[model samples]
Target: MSYSVHVLHNGYSYLKDGVMRANCTCTLIKGPNLVIVDTMTAWDKDVLLEGLAKENTSCADVKYAVGTHGHSDHLGNLNLFTAATHIVGYSVSYKDEFFIHPFETGEPYKIDDSLQVIPTPGHTTEDVSVVVKTAHQGTVVVAGDLFEREEDISDPSLWRYIAGSENPDKQQKYRNEVILLADHIVPGHGPMFKVTEDMKDVARRDQLTQK
Candidate 1:
């Protein structure tokens, strides 16, 4: 089955008082399974519920709730998705029941033929990114903090200085990999952006070799 990716909410991030005040981008994928990626902050719960209602989906219908990382901004509203199989970073759970998955070792969790969750890390070392293949969008990568925004593709410093990635080198490497694999990307704290050859070139950490 083919899937459709929807940007339920585009998040924002800004630096203030040596702190990053941020909200994570929340996405929805509908196909074989109803998936919600990054629930956003708790304060935005009502807004998230409303967004789901508008799509004719309820929290109860969601089969999977994926938090790109353990950050509060990303998983704050997870309590709303109790029935969903929860994927928070490298851990998977449902209520008190837990299931093991080797995300840390690069094993991707497949939700369906059209959707999969791949380990991305870098932001906090256990981060994940959702990849959706749709008829219209081709392939869309729901990249969490691995990319702060579209500008991060062109300016490395924009993300390096603000995202505080735990492993800058790995983040950069995977960011390049995602850019190469995706037709579009939904970044952590910004609007979606189209992938282009120029963007791929800019994202690559090593320019000596060509792909």
Candidate 2:
């Protein structure tokens, strides 16, 4: 079956007089087994439900609820999908039962020919991203904080410094990896963007910044 990526909720992060506020992007993978990536914050419950309804999907329609990482803003609504498999960070589980999965530190977990989940750390060691093969877009990577926002390509500080990167050095490496592979990236806290040379340059520039 074919798969496509859809953003249910666009994420954002901004500073308000020294205080930072943010929410993670929520994305849906439409295919044989529907997958929802990054549930956003818990407070956005009503909005999330409405977003799913708008897509003609219900909570039960989603087979997988994936949290790119264990951040509160990303996995807050996990409880709503008890029937679906929850892939948070490197671990997979169904309610109270945890399951072992090889997505841990190597190789992308293949869901089907059209979709897979890659192990993309650096935002946090356990971070992961959903990669979907779409006909129009080619390859769409629902990267978590790995890309941040499209603006982060020009101003790395927005994601590395202000947003708090656990490992800027490691983050830069994965940033380059994803940029090279994806035609479009759905970032953790911003709108999706088409890959451009500038984005590639920024990813490469990070190596120089460290020197």
Candidate 3:
């Protein structure tokens, strides 16, 4: 089964009143089932919902709401999708009938034939990236902080902002694995881009450097 992936936001960080505010990229997968990858920040709830409305989709239509990690920016608005199944790496409580599911690393949770949630822990111990088999793009990976942007693959320093990422070696390994697994990547905080051979080579070089 093939699906269509839509990027609701190309995340970025900027200063507002001398305070840093960031938004994580949010993506929606439309196929046999509707799936929302990330929910950006709490402040973006309105925009996110509006974007879905513009697409003729609503939170109630979402079958699954999967957060790439536990970061506030990525899972802040999860409660808004009360009609969808919430999947996360860590445990959380919700007052509604909505079920909160927990996923582990190395296991791919199949939402449908076209969508799979694969653990890509690096930014956080529970980070998971969603792999969607798209009709036009082949395999598209909604990588959370695994690859924040295209340059993050080659820049080790970019990992510095990853909260609780203590194992740099393991993190680099996961990064390489995600890049190899994705044909196109919707990074956690940047526009979607193709994962070409050149990008793979760069990731390889970065891996070697880390070793």
Candidate 4:
């Protein structure tokens, strides 16, 4: 089955009390069931709800809420999805009424025939990326901090620098794997962009450097 993915916020950032608050990219996947990938910060709760309302969906309609990792900006509004199943890494802890399932590496959670949640683990040890097969876009990946932006592919070292990755080598390996597999990617804090041959070459070079 084909699915539609909507970007609620594409790398949105704002100033709050002189502090720059970055909002992670939040996506809503509409398929056999409603699934939300990475709910934005708590302050963006209204914005998230508004986006869902525009789609004729509310928090109640969401069946699953998946967090790429346990970051404030990524899982801040997680509690709002009280009716949906919350999926996160085993290390994450939350108090909610809904069921919370923790996923481990190498275990792919199939949301549907078109959507599969796979552990990408680059930006953080617990990171996961969602792979969606759309009718128009063959394989679209919802990458969390795995790729903050498209530039990360060209400058792969930036991910290690910015994320302060514990296992930089492993991160680069997983990132290269994702780059080779995904056709298009929705980054954690950037607009969706096509995965180009040039990007793949750059990623390959970065992978070689990690050896």
How do these models rank on lDDT, best leading? Answer: 1, 2, 4, 3
lDDT of 4 by residue, 1-211 (tens): 5687888888744457877657799999887878898898878888898888888888988887889888888988988887777777433333444333455547777777888888877567788888988888768899888887777666656566654576777677878888888889988888888989987887788778877
Candidate 3 segments exceeding 4 Å error: 14-19, 90-105, 161-164, 204-211
lDDT of 2 by residue, 1-211 (tens): 6777889999999999998899988998888989999999889899889989988988998999999998999988988887799889898888889978786557787888888888988889889988888878889999998878989877989879877788887788888889978899999999889998777776677656766
Q: What is the lDDT of residue 192 in candidate 1?
A: 86
Candidate models: Cα lDDT each: 0.89, 0.87, 0.78, 0.79
Query: What would the TM-scores of all predictions be?
Result: 0.94, 0.92, 0.85, 0.85
Best by TM-score: 1
Q: What is the lDDT of residue 52 in candidate 2?
A: 91
Which scores better on TM-score, 1 or 3? 1
Residue 55 accuracy (lDDT) in model 4: 86
RMSD of 2: 2.1
Off by over 4 Å in 1: 16-19, 203-211
lDDT of prediction 1: 0.89
Q: After superposition, how far is residue 206 of candidate 4 from its true place, in Å?
A: 5.1
Q: At residue 9, what lDDT does model 1 achieve?
A: 95
